[model samples]
Target: MITDGAAMGRKSVGKEYPSHGSVLGGKPNRCVIHPLQSSMVAEALERRNKDWIVRTKDATDLIVQVGDFSFHLHKLAMVSKSGYLRRLAFAERSGEENGSSLKIILEDLPGGTKSFELVVSFCYGGKIDVTATNIAPLYCAATFLEMTEDLQQGNLISKTEAFLSYLMLSSWKDTFQILKSCESVSSWSKELLIVKRCSDAIAWKACIDPKAFATLEEDEAFCLTLLANSHGNLNVEESSEKWWFEDVSTLRIDHFVQVIESIKSRGMKSELVGSCIAHWTVKWFSRITSGFDNLTPKHLAQKLQRITIESLIKMLPMEKNSVSCNFLLHLLKLGLTKQINSEALSKLERRIAFMLEECSVQDLLVKNYGSKDTTYDVGIIIRVVKTYALFALKYSEPRVCIVGRLMDGYLPLIAKDTNLTVDDFKSLAEALPTNARYSDDNLYKAMDMYLLAHPNLTEEERTNVCGAMQYHRLSQDARQHVMKNDRLPLKIVREFMLLEQVKMARSITACESNDHPRTKTRTIMKVTKGLDRGCLTPKREISMIRKEVENMKMQLDQLQTCKVKLQRQVKRCIK
Candidate 1:
């Protein structure tokens, strides 16, 4: 019996049991199959025995090396899992004609050792543990090895692709996840269709809810994590809410550019991109000025070298917000080196000209001036424009181009905004130094041309135009023309007439004083009526009030003179 036990153990040395069997005590019954137990048994046997594929590493076959680790893998097993290895194996096997195994080392695998390890391990053992730390490299190696969609080794290719599609690719459902994942993969996704597919998914998400991406705006971890590991511990609950102005450190320029282009292609609101870019650039500058701590890959000595400054500026997804100007300014600053070429200068000219032409300068001023952080934001813009203006002045041709763009855009785009509002005009009037960029005569000429081109405008349209003229501060000539002209909308003409009538009534009342109670009440009524329905200019309203007060002063002066005359008459009567 002892001899039989020893014999049985010897026979069972490398045998895989689907579960613990009855071999030790009695005749082995049919092994009860538990799916989980079977998997565990196979895994244990594959690791401990190392007998999945013959491990002799015969010089008669293929030798695979990864760094210091070397594997004496069989040609049949390696060639079966990877076409890349297959081609290398057979090509070397036949050509060398030496009876030695072909030794091939992998140097360019991402995740380096770990990446090669995952894919190489799969080729030998027919299975691998796909992990966050290893999935990125595993995907790269598997792709490089041409192990795609093949069922040759326990579906090795399928399993690797599954890891990429689910964990790596699917994680980009929101902006934060997309950014974080892209950071890990770096230039890998651009080599594959995964990132572009994810972008398409976001495009679909945008159609469902344009603001669905806004959640990413609030996530600081996604933006900061690449430089510092501090932002990594987000839980499922925290990641549920997911989401350019720019001082760009070129380290993450590829990822950042990819992200922005994705948003633009998906048709996200550009204002969101603008605000996010502003915040991101500030953070980047802080990290950079802090001695470039963890922001590695100093290859950025050639800033934006991969993409031209003008191309990048043109490519930036800009909304109609001032922060878009911030992005433009950053690109312009990068291009402001002393040795700027004309090609660069021309592209800069085209873009700066676009900024002056395509963007609503007057509208941007209105938005910026209305912003709560006007001093800081508007101040930054003023400095950026000043920089651009200095650049423009450097070349007389660019300067002319800049001026032409401003003039052309001012007429069709800014001055004649079909949706022009009183607030916008007021903003423009206030920002004359910032906006006009030309003589007042030119501004007035553009305004006149706009109105003339759209003559026979509807009553409401003309009223809005006239109200902007009346209510907001305008060029003196524009104000006078709108206030007094017969060719203007009749209702606008009546508004000024009513305002004048109201002013005269108030002046007469001030002369009469409170002693004339009826006149005082009547003048108040007229003043109230003229201000009704939002018609009169605010400046005109102030002028009416001042004239009334002035009329009272004149009346008081005349009365004092009359009293003096009366004193003279009384003296004569007494004589």
Candidate 2:
């Protein structure tokens, strides 16, 4: 119970309406006025009455003790401003009516008396001073009491905590300071649920406050603890990071799992615990596959643990283009490690096998070999092809053949691609397997284009492009053009001179061999003559000839495509 003896002290809040009829310092009421002057005095009294209902503290109902400070606040003012207070007021009304007490003790209230006083001010005048030091406590206290803004301003529900976090993200030093400070606050994620609310804010300021990571790095326990904390009433899709796990995997796995077990002993909602564990485990495994992006909301939901395999099957990518290869790899790892076992693991294996068979040949190449959009490391594309080629050698009729052809075809195009640098091509060369080298290697073609472009292969000051490709092999014509002296080998000169003698010997040998025709083999003959040669009358041979012609036409088309791509490379070199 609080004594009302502070009434006299409360009256000195501010300048008040001095006695209605008195002069300065309560001197006297002897001054008189005419009817016109009297009317003005009456109007002044009316104005004062209209304003004094809240200001005149003649009937304060509650004394809110915040730390060492006390606020003499109206019961209606506090109740209307806070849902928690309204409940307390209702419960205490009978006790107050029996004259027990008019005080509300806020034991260990967050934000101290000044911040609460600001709350009181807002209740009275709709204004409160907000600063970095006080803003956090103000928000936490408001959140604790479920205090909402005035509904007349159009807010439909009470969630001042989220709004406060949202506002905190806008400033530079403040956002970083708040994020670092809040991490050590103990059970903030489990109890306060600030992680999701502040995630985007933290990301935006990571650049501005590079040391923002120092807090988490110095305190590994804090990051792991955040992962294990159970959540409720969470907005699952609040973050749609294109690659969320890439950031989340910064947390240490062994320490994170240990922290999770400790928190689980204290009792967490099973669903939340399961979801957190599954997602974190998936992210941990994603690091090995280098496919953290495969675990984000773009591919899998956070609540995947709660969903059945049947639902997951529907959600999983049926086509190779849609396949989260890393995710399936994670499931297989989970099975082998016995992290997931029994029927679930069996089903997972089946799903993976089906995905492997149904996967798009083209898409699998892009996913593993590195495509332009998703792959960040320049050389991953090369290794992707190399690995695929290795996988093919084990099978006599291997699907790796598809990858093999693509590897050969894409090498020159990718090496000469304007998007990639010569250093990138060098990395590719380093990783490329020796056996996979011969087919359509672009290493030489790239240098040839460069040598041709500069006019004087000797003219340039040796760019990274020149330094990398200088020793690469080139064609006879390109070598002779200007880069190298035209020199014919002795063997080639001798062979050229003996061509007529070889032709005569081959003609005599052919005449002797054709003396006895064999029945085992079919020989093609050029049988056109004026009046001596006879034609082979058969539609079957005609069809075979057409088939050969068509095959040659297809080969010609592919050659033309390669020619066009080579031209584009040359243009890029000139540019």
Candidate 3:
């Protein structure tokens, strides 16, 4: 945890070190080269088939085997710097004869042979160059060998720790490099707190404003081209708040979570944190194919993805709209596919439900690639809709209506999936409040589509599926389509006809009342008693009722004929 006092303390020490990118690659000043010493070690290690014979005044008595590479060196020099080597050098070897060359096999050396070579060079008084690339593993290797100041003055452990401290305090990119390099030496890094310290540094840098630092050079810039408002600074073009997103997202999950928690604890804005999380998640999606299932060793890949998704869900900011609703929906789908923890999964659902209005039809159409499941994931969305309904009062009317419209657009798409169950479809359609939609034309269209796709449905199933829609709210064109749609249940079609007749009867009576002042006065009295709903005044209601009555008389003459034709057509279709 990088506390405020610690972060401020680091600021003064940071100025003593040179700015980042001054000593790394892409500059005229490259890191120091110790070619002669490097060649000495490389030449000795290259002779794997033969005993390594060093061309030195003293005969080499020690054979150090690091992986496939072996080095011929003096035991005195090795034992002096490494506590592990000192303990091993004097350990009894039962099979070995006296005066024979002693060989030590180091299979578990951190940083592998490349990092061990630096340790060997350090032991031999050769210059050891520490850079962002090698600092992490080098530190781990030195620690593993126990090259501490207690054994020798100005030891590898102390020197590397100092460099790591400087890198963590001063440079943003170096901290990321150190954390990435720790992947190969995870255990050692964690033990040494290198991972935690690097994560803290990154979190601190992210929480602080980038304008405090000098303009970054092109080589050090995280995304120079993408940062339009950066003016050569660290702020990203997407948003100034997202300056650290690209860099931090490069970290693997474990280290990424550490930094995220650190940042969260610093009281950074939840929306900024959420945007960063979403950015990281989107990057992960782009790398993956169909899913983690496509990876070799299916079970392991799925388990890893499940763990990662659960961690991400657990780390999400609690504030609303912190993440985009689209990302949340996609994450929810992935969570279901991965079978993440129920608590984390429910958290995702609640967040998505809170912002359901922001989602689109495509966003909700989470396709089920499972062998036994329906073409679309109706269950998850149904769960989300139920959750939204629970909190419906907390939301405004327009937002609820927007979600209803979104569901309306969504239902038609899912209805095309023949395997979708009527129960699932009906549950989702009726999940919202009764007043969620001022119009039911879209719902009617969806119900019609479902009926068309599922011609084998029982009459009761079709009635149940279409029952959620209000027939009176259907537009004139939708009413006409409904009358002609033979896939509809005869019972539902008859009910629609009855409702249409009632509406027409009301219209005719109201229109007639418009012509007679006495009838209109009676209509006004009824309206004063709050008989009408949703902004309908006495005059408007009476006129609409009279007009509907006129229409009812005209349609009644044809209603019987239409009903008979629809009933015969529906029965034929069912047959």
Candidate 4:
């Protein structure tokens, strides 16, 4: 009976259970097993008598140990099909301790223990159900065991080679399956050129229309596995040009990189390639951040993430806007967190700066998690904004204004954090040119929020913080708020007060100009129109004069309103 390596025991084979024979005649039939079904399959194999161990051990003359698994077999059964085993058997026979079983330890077997189990089964004339998932490792294990045709006809090496060729040429999904499977025995797969061949096949399929290839029944199962791996985020519909991305992204870094290089060599568009890199970053980094990879050690996972981000940066397309500005900012953020190389971080910063107008305030609000006494990574934003300001010189004024307002809107949010230093706040406020913001309402609001949060600022520091604001550009509402605010330094308040007086004086002069003598005379003539109709009685004249007096009183009330505004300004100035 067959069983897992972890539950090996002696059992007799029964004729009732049929073997899914080798790929020599026809493709093997096997169902994909879930973890629970894998155990079920093991139990079924045990009951059916396809033993992981040989049927009898009394005549066994050979023991092969791979990792924690041991296989007992007759020397004749093993030596006839394996050159390496034959040599080991001969060496054992020639030694002084020849009476004991010939023991061979494969410490670094290509596919580890389970794959070696398959090799042992093949040596015993058992069926080998080779599929895409096991093909690479099994082929490598067979190669390592030297199970070549020279040792026996229709041997493992020849059979697996044929299977590999057929699978690579059969369909798109099979080629990817082979490539992904190679990740288990990565170095050996590369050494045997399995990775290269599969990468080329995938690249060729990806470069042309995928409709040319057959979408066999197995591909549905393969796509479902990808969908599960990606947490149901991957769309594997044939209509999507990126149906292959989810499958390709499942590969480890080295294998994935090789496949990408192959695709690039086939002249795929840089934008599409960049998009793939972005997708991979989102998928894998989310895995790292979400803490789903519990099997991997923390430090090792971090190391892998660092490598992933660094490789992605190097793989980014040089074309402008190939990726969104938000993505570049995200990479820069992770790059900072991972402490990646400064050169790469610098590249991300510059790329972000080049497209800074596309960014929003929230995008730049990367929280500070370091020794810096700030609520956010204000320094990173400062650097990015400074670089963007320099780049803005060549662009249109509207674009510069966009970044300007983005920063303006960002300042108030960061200013509320008591830990944020005044210097960082001031640097961000003044990062753009004076003309970047056509109005300083938001900036003034930000300054007020900062001053309120940090009340211990020295007068000079307050002056420096307030210097970035242009009082004249402030909206009237902002101007009024500032005029009433007591947190502002006395010097700024006094300067703004002087400007307010000048503004009030200009307003009064304009009002007086509109009240010219001609206007007053016209108003009186309209009120006395009944006198011209010959109803010039004393009582009527008296009522007409009273109406003129009421008109004059209304004009006085308008002047009184202006006077009240001046008085309030004077009171604020005194404070």
Candidate 5:
């Protein structure tokens, strides 16, 4: 019988097995080695003959052959903490088949050298399953190996994949993280391309910081344009909330103009152009208006003529009337005063003529006034024209002619027939008041009356007469004479009084109706008082009293009849 300690030693020795050393028969008293043990010993002896395998204190490096293939295993880390030697021994003893088919060659990797083959697999693999838990280890390994392709491939997957991609990409700190980790130029390019293609605002924001982009001119311009275009589609209030492009205020005007011109050159569709124009107008209205307003009339005319008629029309709908009319007046004024190129002046003239014909002065005013849709009142057109004429009259002779003609066609009617007389109209027309508060309809009416009063007037005569009338101040005596003769219509006066009475009655009724609760309370109190004072009970009380009196009277009447009969009998006996 073996002692327990001796049996335990034998079993412990049996359980532990070396990966390389032979376990075959050797010395029985020394340690009875099996046949497989002898084979392992022979392999170890052969491995010792080769200089490639290194045995160190921390780990072991071995080139092992299993089947046809060979693989390297670094021994700086333990192969198995629970002991692979024990499993190998058990497999040898049980004659069980080893699951591994590929030969694994163990080679020690020094601290400086990297296992780059692992990186290649990671990069080119059909599918990579990287999670947060494993990412740090993978990233460390990738970095140590200088795995540019793998890092870039990872970045591409992170950006292109669905929600997982976004989460991973956003998890990165900055562009440098991608740059440092990636090995290939193409991989780095892919990173940039992925960032550029990112549609999520948050993802894009994470990829490219505005400050970083600002250093690259091309990138900065691209980013600004992208942001501007994006902002254009957003509601004004929503865009204001983001204010993402607020830094764009620092861009020079020329840069901004270049951006705008580039966008325009792309052939903007109506909706896009409208949105862009709206955003531009809101962002730079005062600046654009002031700058454009400062340009010489000739310069403005040249610029205006260069633009397509369609573009000009689009601009018109977006601009304030004052700004639009000012631009138009500038072109017209330039055509009259400056010696501009004939072609340019001709275009301006054609555009102006087309606009006037299409947008008739009367029709525009009536349409705008009737709809109450315009920012400026309909009267602004008259003031704008008058201002243009006055300014033109001061500078050039042709302008005077143009002004005279305009007055003949439109202003004369405004002055003579409308409430604005020739003199009051002239004062307003010459002064060109900015606030055109007076009713334009009155001006139209006055002009109509004057035209009716003077029949068969030649066009030239009418022009001169209207121009002269602009200077003619009507005398107070004449105004009084006109007023005295123009008495209010009796029917109108009677109707006015009737309307006043009806309005007063309605007001009184409304006031009384509103006080109904209080009135009803007072009325109810009076009724209740009358009821309590026996006025309501008096009817019942009087009816009862009268019934009793009637009964008494009937009884007395019967007694009286009896006494009369007795007296009658007595009289008869005496007779």
Candidate 6:
């Protein structure tokens, strides 16, 4: 009696169909009476049943379904824009019986129709092979879909080399615009390298179109430096046969300085400063120092003085000797005669002192000033003595004396209390002849001898002597020697003496005070012993105890008064 109506309905249709009334419906036949109507019915059934055959629009759409989730043909095209899918076009679909489930059934299409199919496949959740035509579109589509894996695959397929080649071959304006769109540092660097390798400076200059040299940022500096170095020898000679030098004046020095300082501040390893300095120095040395013969004495003196001062202050200490000492000395003498500022003179004096302190004394005495034998000229001796005396008086005898007897004559000149004004010191210094010849050690010794003979000198005088002795190359032995003679007005020595006296007095007082504590302790112990021995009678103890008891009774009376007041308030509130 079972008519098997479902089987008859399927068999009578004369189309291969899914088993009728199976656990679930079998695969739906696309060739049913109305093909489109059948598909609509299948789709509706899929919604109702929660399961149905997935019929893709095309082979590519079918492939995407097997590998990735269902997607429209347009989406797949966008995802594979970098040509990644195109490269995988012939790849076999795994877990299939025929080894190839993505075979194209319809091969022929109208012109541009192939692209239309790809777009459709993409829209139908199908992945199209990425090709040059689809790359850009795919990138946009993948980015829109937020398909990170697809985007990464596209990037790999695109390759930096290919992109750079495209940039080089494409329109310069377009390439620059594209580069500007890159946001990440890595992407920018990659693009810049490509531009550097293929394009000329003009092209790169066009890209950034810098209006002024100062407009360069750190990244621009890196790019420009690379460009400049690649061009080779920025200071190359303009003329043939090496007749004319490179015209580096065209290179903006201010900009160069800015760039170098920026790089140095950022701790970069570029040698821009060094290269610029070397080049500029070579070009400007002659021009800067030209017309020496025409230079006025005033101008020459001023220029030399500035150079010497700058050299002394800024040049490495080790290189001071490399400078012309004679030139420095000549300028110093001129400065003195011209009555230049005392500060300048003071600096010159320090420089000379530094040089003398650094050099061997015997060399100065023998090589420059001649023999220090007893036959030494009186003029030399007098000049040496006077020079030392001026130095000692101006600063202090002790500071100069520390250098020895060569400065002894300077000691007697140190005033008792008043400091010699700069003008006074300068006048005294100018009066001193230039033939000073005493050794430094001898000067210190003589100063010490002079101080010892002048014990009545004031505190200021002693301080001046100590200051001079400590000034330059003064030996420790000489310092101690000057210190031993209280006649040398050294404030440190006097202060030290006063400090020692104060400390000693304090110690004596402390010792005396300590004796008082011991005495008091003995008295207390004796009294306690007398009490224990009953030498102190109970009557005396009772009187002392009664005093303590009376004090406690007064404290108790105050507390009772406070309690009475509190009770009165409580009784009134209860009422």
Per-model TM against the reference? 0.45, 0.28, 0.70, 0.65, 0.22, 0.19
Per-model CA lDDT versus the true structure = 0.46, 0.40, 0.72, 0.69, 0.34, 0.35
lDDT of 6 at 259: 28
Candidates ranked, most accurate by lDDT first = 3, 4, 1, 2, 6, 5
lDDT (Cα) of model 6: 0.35
Model 5: residue 442 alpha-carbon error in angstroms? 9.8
Which model is ahead, 3 or 4, in terms of lDDT? 3
Expressed as tens digits, the lDDT of each residue in 24-113 for candidate 4 is: 122332211111111001111111233245664345566777776666666776777778878877876643275777778779888897
Give the clash count for model 6: 45
The runs of at least 3 residues in candidate 2 whose Cα sits more than 4 Å from the true structure, single-residue gaps closed, are 1-143, 146-320, 323-398, 414-423, 434-438, 441-447, 450-575
lDDT of 1 by residue, 1-575 (tens): 11112211111111111112111121221111011101111122122232122333233265566655565556665676678887777666553586566788766655555565455455545344443334445556667788744535334444545434443322322222333444555667567655565445444443343223225553333333321222234443222212212212222555555556766676666665555455555565465547764454555543434244444555555444435543555545445532345576555445544465344444234222234332222332333344345445454564444444454344344445444443443333333233324334444455455466566666566555444343233454555454554445666555554554555566566655467689778666756654564576745654564454356446556756776788899999999
* Candidate numbers sorted by TM-score from highest down: 3, 4, 1, 2, 5, 6
The true-versus-predicted C-alpha distance at residue 216 of model 5, in Å, is 27
lDDT for position 232 in model 3? 39
Write one digit per residue (lDDT tens) for candidate 5, span 1-575: 11223211111111111111111111111111111101011111113322223223323333333233233333212122112322333344322244322223323221111222222222222123333222323343333334332323223222222322323343322222222222222233333432222223222442234334234755455444444554666675544333333322222232333333433444433343334333443444345445654655856745543442223333433322212333453444423434445555545444443333233334323222234343223243443454344444344454344433443345543433323333444443443322221223333334435545555555443343334221113343332222222122222222223333333333333334454656545533432332233443533433333343344335445646776788899999999
**Per-residue lDDT tens digits of candidate 3, residues 1-575?**
22222211111222212223221222111122121212223223334463444445567788888887787887777787789988888894532468776888888999988898778776765655567778889888888889877776667776677667877887766777788889999998988899888888878877876654545663245333334422234434445567567777777888989899889888888988988888788777766664645755878887888999998888988887777776777788888877889988888888888777777777776666778788878888898999999999887898889888988888888888888888899999999998799889889888888888888989789889988877768888897667556687766665565555555545544545245657545533543443334597534544454444345567555655676788899999999
Candidate scoring better on TM-score of 5 and 6:
5
Evaluate model 4: give its lDDT.
0.69
TM-score of 2: 0.28
Q: Mind giving the per-residue lDDT tens digits that candidate 6 earns over 100-159?
A: 444222122111233333334333333344322233332333232333334443232233
Runs of candidate 6 exceeding 4 Å displacement: 1-89, 95-173, 180-470, 473-575
Error of 4 at 420 (Å): 5.8
- Candidate 1 lDDT score at position 242: 22
**Which tens-of-lDDT digit does each residue in 1-575 have in candidate 2?**
11113101111111111122110111211101011111011111111321222344345567666655555557765676577777788887775787653677786555555556556655554333343334456556666566655422211113234334534554333433344434433243335644333444434432232234335554353223322332222333321111122232233432233334433444433443344445655655456458554656742532333233223333343334343544554444434433333555556555543344334434233222346432223343443434444444564443433443444444444443444554555555443334344333354455444334434322222243333322223343332232221122222222222332233333333433355554112211211111121363323333333344344335445656776788899999999
Best of the two (1, 2) by lDDT: 1
Top candidate by lDDT:
3
lDDT of 5 at 456: 57
Clashes (candidate 1): 6
Worst ten-residue run, lDDT, model 6?
Answer: 30-39
